[model samples]
Target: MTAIGFVTRTTHGGFSGELNLLPICAHIDIVPNRDKSGDTSPDFRIFTQGVEVGSGRILSGESRGTDYVSLSLAAPGLGVRKLCANLGRTVGLNGDGSFFLIWNSVD
Candidate 1:
């Protein structure tokens, strides 16, 4: 896997940064904010392969006592299949201020 861009958490323990998708020419922008109940807002924007795909605020969910956030993004008409196929294995941020979207083969 290769790192495409980097991200940093804000003072409020939320993500507020920019990440470049590299070679693909896409970018991700994250904005951190809280609601009246102190819930972190998932305000994010996604650009797929250099074109603006989708944008929205995701709601947080819990599973097995663990809280997590999930997001789904895709370009108009083209759908997520293409984006997912292109992104590959996993797309995640590292605690070390780096992010990567890799395509891994399970051999």
Candidate 2:
């Protein structure tokens, strides 16, 4: 089981409720080896709030041997506040591994 939580937020007294993120969490399993058939690359998609925000090739030599994918989201322009983010990843072709996180606001 994979769990994530903010020890504390810098801005407010009660920050947990605003994010919809639990103190602990778990994601689906990912396949160990996706190269069984020696295909070029695996297909992967990432969604936030049930909306497809990002998609790309998984381990297709972009970073080399990176079993994990990452993303960073921030307000479009500087000096703008009130923001939240959710990141998700699917490791391999078998659809056995997945992970996600909901980030608290910076405001």
Candidate 3:
């Protein structure tokens, strides 16, 4: 797993921070999707440079009841499958901020 971003909670129940993907470091915002109409709808929207790039679904750990954000980022350069990640608490991530966007790749 790789720590790709550092984010902190915002006063409006959102998150704002920097998404550092090597040479592309941009300030990003994880804002609540207030217009969501169904349970399957994304709970949050991710924006970078004022453009929507991804979405986040609220999730909970099965055993520990830990809160998490299941994120999906899609870009023309990222290919057919959207990049998926789990934004979880920073407790043991060895990173900054209250949450970390962790990328877990299966071999």
Candidate 4:
């Protein structure tokens, strides 16, 4: 897992970060998706400025059973396939800054 972004916890319980998705990078805000009423609904919504770009769901870690955000990110700026990633504790940061937005690799 490669961390492509850094996010800090917001006062409103959301996250504010800068995402670098190679061809397209932007300052992003991760906020709760208030319309989550079903199992498949996204747990959180992602935005750049005011435009929605993606969403995420809470996922359990495979090795440790810990929780993390599974992101399904997409926009016209991005390619046809969605950019899937994970949000978790940074290795060196130790959750101090919540330095994350790990890119999940297909290989």
Task: Locate the minimum summed-lDDT window of 10 residues in model 1.
Answer: 82-91
Query: Which has the greatest TM-score?
Result: 4
User: How does residue 7 of candidate 1 score in lDDT?
Assistant: 43
| Highest-lDDT candidate | 4
What is the lDDT for 40 in model 3?
82
TM-score of each: 0.35, 0.23, 0.82, 0.87
- 1 versus 2: better lDDT goes to: 1
Ordered by TM-score, highest first, the candidates read: 4, 3, 1, 2
Q: Residue 101 CA error for candidate 2 (Å)? A: 10
Off-target runs (Cα >4 Å) in candidate 4 are 92-97
lDDT of 4 by residue, 34-63 (tens): 778999888899999899999988888899
The digit string of per-residue lDDT tens for model 2 on 2-56 reads: 3232212113211121122333131211222224344544233333344333332
- In TM-score terms, candidate 2 sits at 0.23
lDDT of 1 at 69: 28
Q: What lDDT is reached at residue 43 by model 2?
A: 39
- lDDT (C-alpha, whole model) for all candidates: 0.39, 0.31, 0.82, 0.84
* lDDT tens digits, residue span 1-107, model 3: 79888888888888898777764677889999999999988999999888999999988889989788888887665567677778767886544458887875632
lDDT of 1 by residue, 1-107 (tens): 55433445446544333434433444454333233233343354444445545433444335555433233345545433533211212235355543333332222
Error of 3 at 75 (Å): 1.6
TM-score for predicted model 4 compared with the true structure: 0.87
